[model samples]
Structure formats: structure tokens, C-alpha cells
Target chain A: MVEQALENAIPGDWRVNERLKEAAIYSLAAGGKRLRPIFVLAAAEAVHGDEKAASLAMPFAVAVEMVHTYSLIHDDLPAMDNDDYRRGIPTNHKVFGEATAILAGDGLLTHAFYVASEAAAIGVPAERTLAVVRDLARLAGFPGMVGGQADDMEGAQGITSIDQLEHIHLHKTSDLIAFSLRAGGHAAGATDRQLEALARFGTNVGLAFQIQDDILDITGDQDKLGKPVGSDERQGKVTYPYLIGLEQSRRRVEELTEQAISAVRSAELADSGRLEQIAMRLISRDN
Target chain B: MVEQALENAIPGDWRVNERLKEAAIYSLAAGGKRLRPIFVLAAAEAVHGDEKAASLAMPFAVAVEMVHTYSLIHDDLPAMDNDDYRRGIPTNHKVFGEATAILAGDGLLTHAFYVASEAAAIGVPAERTLAVVRDLARLAGFPGMVGGQADDMEGAQGITSIDQLEHIHLHKTSDLIAFSLRAGGHAAGATDRQLEALARFGTNVGLAFQIQDDILDITGDQDKLGKPVGSDERQGKVTYPYLIGLEQSRRRVEELTEQAISAVRSAELADSGRLEQIAMRLISRDN
Candidate 1:
């Protein structure tokens, strides 16, 4: 159902420049769980808003995915991660060449916000739309995702503590997820109290998601994971699983998951059933 | 005077967060011509508008500079341009280290749009504000600057035709300038015809600016240039000077300057003296 909704939301005009259309489609269609947009839609509905309230978050959802894809493209560059495979296919730089990959990443990143701003133009109230923009910018910009990425790059080449690893993941992966929830709430005219609750929920869930990822990196099957296991260790990178033993990491995940679930319940949202299911699925994923 | 203006514009309280503030200050303080913001101001004034009219354009101007700086930082990366110096000092990655440099660039790039949206909350008419946002996105996004950067990256490694080089410059350099002018006009309530004229002016002047850069790269004193003489050739990078020869490039610059000046004059703007002078100075620049 979610996949069908995403397909319908995506613009399907073939009359646009084929190369750009193809590139945009290729990057987006390369699958991952569409968790960010789902969070957005769910948050809106939970607040007694319609799917149209999710419209403000739609371009942003696609945009967040673009930013994620771009990061993957650049990370896979020979100078960076040097990984040849991602999601079971050759990474963008490998297929498109380094220069194109760099540009492709850049293109997607800039276009994400541009596309997202369509919300304001399309009748989301000015203040509400601006809030969404602010949320996205703060989450994605220097103090957040970019800063986290820098920390990760440094940590990869040097020794880092578990706390530091948490900091890195909080910004790099979790901030955007948090923004997804908050942006959806803003679109739906959520109260400040509700927004704060959602923010808390997103933050905890994001950290849990990263911890699960680290655990999966060590324990999951290569085929299901779509990349080699132990690449972090091979690259001398530190992760939650590396700093804390596997058992502790599992315990931490459980704690975070509970925290996330509690935050959602505290918000007293009407339609949080789906979000609860999502949180459970995220924490319990094997791959 | 310009420095004072900028000082007034930026928040004074930014120093509270020491590290993040330092990073932000370091990048913002690293001085350039401030061409983008000046264009925003001048374009607004030329349309019989005031600074308030161009407030939306201010963040965009700052954002454009951030994007420009990011490109420079990335271009100077070891895997890319590998320049050791910029603006008479060590390049960003050199002073800050590659990891921090990368983050700084990413930070500035993302923050640019965040800054631009300030006008949205401050009550710029929704239509006008959206127009500014859209223009910035288009100029800075894939089809514009990033596209140009891609072309430059490809052209750097091998031979490229003069037309391809022009395309690169047009996208890489010219589009933003065009955006600057158009955004200013939009802010100041310029008529569609007036904005169109300024766009023409921007395009011609932008091309001229690149030609002058090419000329400076080839013929200017290394000490004054602050980098190196013949760096383009050293990198095997194709540029205007490389394709058309210095004499033809100079001629093209003059032609473009004249055309730009004429366009600005033809617009019958209320105040275009500064704009015209800036264009003339740009073409006449020796470094």
C-alpha cells in the first residue's frame, strides 16, 4: 500500500528531459524502506489530518531519499568508502564514473529542497511550510547531518568511543528521520506539544535504527544485507556493536525501542498504531 | 563599508557555540568580492526597490556564496583540483584537514538555502518568496552549477570542445549570476520585461567574468593571482583561454561586457550606474 502511494505521488512525465528523468527515477527506484515519508504520512494522520496534509512532506520525502542516495554515491567513491557494491548493485560512481556520480549526488541534494519547497507554493500555510523548511535545513545542514558525516569520516580513520559513535549516528542518520516526523506534524497543523513529542519519538527511534544497523552489519547474511559484512571492521571503523559487545548492543536497542514506543504513546496520537508497528519492525529486522 | 554592512547583517550571538560558531565564522569571514549579495542589493535598487524588498535575496546571496565556496573546496580536493592555495591562503582542507574541509563545504552548501528561506517567515509575499526559492534551486541544482561542475570534471581529464567549455561555464558560473540578478528583480517588483533584460545582462556579464578568470589564470602575476600561473594547463583542464587563445578570449570578454552594459542600459532602470560600473570593472580586471 505504501509503495503504491509512493508510485502515484512520483511525477511520471516522460516528456521531461529523458536523462534527468531517468537519473531521478533510477536513484529513487533503487529500493530501500521508504521510512521517512511513511513517518511523515503517519504523523499527519495520527494528528487527525488527511493524506493531503502529507503533501507538504511529499517533496521532502523524495528529497530525503535523494540526500540519502547522494551520500551513498559519494561514500562509495574510491577516495571515500571504496565500496564497489551497494544495495546489491554497483554503486553510482562505479556505474556512472566518479565525476558523474559526484554531480548526480550534488544534483539530487540541491533538487531535494527545491522539490520540497513546492509545499509552500502549493498552499501549505506560509508559517507551517517555513517550519518544515527550517526543520529540514537544520537536520540536513552543517550542525546536523554534515557534521555527523565529518565525525564519521574522522572516526573511521581513528579510534572513537561508543558515545562518539552514538553522536555520529544521531546526526547522520537519525536527524533526518526526526525531521521527517516533525515536518509531517507541521504540515498537519500539529500543536507544539505534539510536535515535541513526535520529535522525541523520532530521535529515539533513529538511534535505535542505527544500533540495529550496526548489529545487522555484524550478524546478518551478506545476501540479505546487500553488501559485505565486517566492512566497517575491515576499514577500521568503530560502531556500537564494536564498542559495546553484541549482547550489550542488543540490550541498548531494546531500551531505545521502548523509549521510542513510550514517546509515541505519550503523544496520545489517535492513529499511532502504524507507527508503533513500524518501530517494532525496525527494531526486529534481521537484515 | 561593505564589511560593516555584512557585520550588521549577520547575527552577533553566533559566537556562543564556540566550535560550530568558529566553523561558520571561518567560512563566512573568508572574504571574496561579495559579488552575489551586491548583485542582490543592486538589482533591487535598480528596480526602484529597497533593501527590504531584497531581503529574501540576501539569504540566497549568502547561499550562492556558500555553494561557490563548496565547489572551490571540493574542486581543490586531492582527487579533484588539488590546489594548495586559494585567496592567498591555504585551501580549506589544507587548514582544517580533509574531513573538516569536506564537512565545512557540505555545511555551507546546505545552509545556503536554509538562510534563503528566512524571508518566508518574515512575511515576504508567498508568490515572490517562492519565486526566489525556485530560481535559486534551478541555478544551483543539477541543470545549473552542478551540471557545470560535472562538465568541468569531465573536461579536466581530457580534451573538450569550445562549445562544451562554454556550456560548462554557462552552467557552472553564469547561471548563478543570472539567478542573482533575476532574484533581485523579483524582490524589488520589477516587471517581467525588466527581469528578462537583467537576465540577459547577467548571462553576458557572467560569461565575461569567466573569460576574465581564464585570462587572469593565464596572464596575471602568480603573486597577485594568489594561486599559480598556468594552473589550468598544469591540471590539463580545458578553459576559455585554452580553447580560443588569449586574444580571442579577450575579444569575447569585451564583446560580452559591451553587450551586458547595453542590456542593463536598455532596461531603462531607475538606478543602474553601479551595475554598469561593476560589469565594466569585471571585464577590465587584471587579476
Candidate 2:
């Protein structure tokens, strides 16, 4: 369903510039876990397990994925992480030139808001819809993902403490992740208390997912990892494992996973089975 | 009013990463015409000369300038325009380096929406506010500015006719310009007729603005222009003068300016005096 929405996003008309379309679709079609959108769905389902709410949140599901894909494209640019590959294929900038890749990312970021604005079409109250849009913008912008990225870049060479690492991880990796559920809760008419629970759940799961990612850099196979191994240390990045040792970081991940499930349970989600499954799978998966 | 709003935008607190804030605020503080925000204010005035409307639109006025500044930062990047100077100072990327510059731009773009979402506090209806948000995203994103930029980059050596040049200018330059008025109209509760008139006026004025900009590149001095003169010709760009000759281009500017004035007159704006003055001044000004 998300795939169909993603495919239908870029206008297929002749006025649609083919190159821009191709570059955006290239990174998007590369395929990841699609966890962000799924989290949105699952959170909404937890509040009210109905087709209506899921349908209302569907466009935003695609929108968040688009935003996620754009971030990956920008992060892989030569001036940034300088990664040559992602998800087992050449990065967008490597495939298309840097300029086009940058523009494509910009295009996706803008289009996400355009898609999110359609909340009204699905009978979302305009006030709530506008709040959803505002939340996405605030949470995605300086106070959220972009700010976290700046911290990451600024801290690249410095020795970092657990606080600094978690700060970066929460914003860079977990802000949008947490918002995925918070926003879905908003869309599903979840009460403030319910939304808070999902936010806590998302935050914990996101941290665990990021910890696993850091762990993967140390242990995952090269071909399966789709990028270089030991890149965090190579890039002078202080990840969870490096700062606190592998054993403690592994334990922390397990704790975070448990906390995430507990959050869902406390929220009294009607159908948290999918969210639970995702959190567990993310923590334990090798790849 | 707009200048103060622009200056006051960035959070001065410690939470704002100083480096990123410096990069973004550096370019924003650089003096320009500040025309976009002014147009937004003026359009609201045209609809109704009310302090309430002006106050309601103020955040968006500042928001548009932020968006414009962010675009300039991105356009000046080494990977993009490669221009080292803007407004007689080193470009954001040149002063801060490329990666920080990119993040700064991302920060501003995201923050613009965050700021714009404040329309609710000012009491603009949610439906109109959402429409405003949608318009900005659509105009700034793929279908408008970004797509036009991609076109400009692709056609650098291939653009041949006045038609293609106008196509690029209308989307890249004029879309946001037109939206400035359309958005202000929404804020001020303009009738559909008034909004249409503002759209027409914006399109004409924006096209003329581009024409005059191209003319300045050919005729203005480097000291006053604050950019390299003859850059369009040097870069193999086909501008108004390159394709249609100086005399006809000048005539075309006159026509567009007159059409802009007539649009306001036909709309019977309550206070279009400022819009008229701006149209005349822009058409006649050397810098």
C-alpha cells in the first residue's frame, strides 16, 4: 500500500521533469524496512484499529518515507558521510550527479509537506491536521533531525560521552521515529496520554534500532551491510559500543527493547502486535 | 516590521548549535531588497488595510524570506552555483564550508514551515492556513523552484529560445513571488477575485523582476551588482538579452510592469499604492 502511494506521488505527466523524477524515485525505490510508515500505521492501529484511520494516515506514511529517503540521499553526499553505496547500490549522488541528487532531496522534502497537507481530504479536522503538519515541520527541522545532524558533524573528531551520543542519536535517528507514532496517534484521535505513551515507545525503539545499527557497523558482513564496516571508528564517530564497550551497549539495546514494549502495553493499544514485532525484529535482526 | 521579524527568527539560546546558527543567520542578515516579505505584507494590505491582517501575515512574511535565504545558500554552494560571493561577502558555503552550509540551508527550510505554522496563533482559519502551507510547499518543491533549477542546470548549454528562458524564470523565480501575494490574500480574507488579481499581478511583476535582473547582469557594475557581471553570458546562459536583444527585452519589461499595475487597478484594492510604487520603482531602478 505504501509502495503504491510512493509510486503514485510524482506526477507522470510530461510537465514532470523526467530526470528529477528518476533521481527521487531511485533512492526511494531502493527499499529499506519501511519502518517509519509502518510505525505510523501501527500506532494509529493501536489507538483505533479501523480502516478509516489507517486510510487517513496512508498519505503521511508515504510522506515520512519520502522524508527518510531524502535524508539518506543527503547524508551520503560527498561533502557529508561520503558513502559510495546504500542498501547494496550506489548512492544517489554517485548515480546522478551531486547537484541533481541535492535537488532531488530538496524536492522530496517539499513534497512531504504537500502530501501531509492532504489530511483534510481524509476527514482529519483542520486544526488537528494543521497541528500534525506543524509538528512534522518542527520535529523534522532545527529542533529535530537537522539539528541532530549538525551535532553529529560537530562532534565528529571529539571524544563524546553517553549523553552526547544519546543526544545525537535521539534527534538524528529517533526524532522522526518518535514522530512517526506521535503523528499517527494525532491522526487516529489518540488522547494526549496515549500519544505520550507512543512517543515514549517510539523513542525507546528508535534508540534500540540505532544501537543495533551501530553494532552492525562492527559485526555485520560487508556484502550484507551494503557499506563499509568499522566506518564509525574510521570516521571518528563515538557510537554506543565505542563509548561504553560492546557488552554494555548490547545490554542497553535489550533494555530499550523491553522498555518499548512496556510503553505499548501501558498505552493499552488495541493492536500493538505489529509494533511489538517490529521493535523485537529491529533489535535482534543481524542485517 | 519584516526586517525585525527576520532578525528575531533564530533562537539565540544555547540549544541552537552555534555553528549552524552562524551559517544561516550570516546570509540572512546580509542586506537585500527584502522584496518577497514586503510583497506579502503589501498584498495583505491591498486586501484590507488592517493591522490585524498585517500582523497575521507577519510570520509568513518572515518565513518567505527565510525560504529565499535558504535557496540562496543552497544555490551558492560549491556543488551548485559555485559562486564564492553574494552581497559582496563570501557565500555561506565559502565562509562556513560546504557541509555546514548544506545543513544550514536545511535548517532554515525546515524552520520556515515551523514559523509559518504560527498562523493559528494569529487567528487565520485552519483551512486557509493549510492551503497556504500547501501552496508554499508546491511552489518551492519539485513542480516549481527545484524542478526549474534542475531544468536550468540541464539546459545550461542548450537553451535556445525566449520561450524556454521564460519557462525557467516563471517557475524558478516567479512561483514563490506569486505565492507571496496568494498567501497574503489568504491571511487577509481576500475574495476569490482579489486573490486571482494578486496572482496575476505577482506573475507579471515576477517576470519583470527576472528580466530586470538579467538586464542588470549585462549592464550593471560589479560594485553595485554585488555579483559578477556578464555571468549569464559567461556561463552560456540564454537570457532575455541573449535571445531577444536589448531593445525588445526592455520593451517587454515595460509591458509586464504595466500589466502588473493594471492587475491591481482591476482588483480595486483598498490600498494598492505601495504595490504601484514598488512596480514603478522596480521597473525603473538601476540596481
lDDT of 2 by residue, A1-287 (tens): 88888888775663656798899999999999899999888888878876567877886788789889988998999999998888889999999999999999988888888888887777878887888788788778887888889888888777468988898888898989988998788888888888888999999999999999999999888777767799888877778999998999999999999998998888877677878888888877877
Per-candidate clash tally: 0, 0
Ten residues in sequence with the least summed lDDT for candidate 1 chain B: B13-22
Model 2 chain B poorest ten-residue lDDT run: B9-18
CA error at residue B214 for candidate 1, angstroms: 2.6
Tell me each candidate's TM-score. Answer: 0.87, 0.96
lDDT of 2 by residue, B1-287 (tens): 88788888865663767788888889889979998898998898888876567888887898888888988998888788899888888899888988899888888887888788788777989888888888888888888888888988888778888888898988889989998998898889888899899988988999999999889999888877767789888877788998998889999999999999999899977888888899999987777
Rate residue B151 of model 1 by lDDT: 61
Cα misplacement distance, residue A87 of candidate 2 (Å): 0.7
TM of chain B, each: 0.88, 0.95
Predicted complex 2: DockQ: 0.70
Error of 2 at B191 (Å): 2.4
Candidate with best lDDT: 2
Predicted candidate 1 versus true structure: per-residue lDDT over A114-154, tens digit per residue: 76777776666766766676677678876678767766776
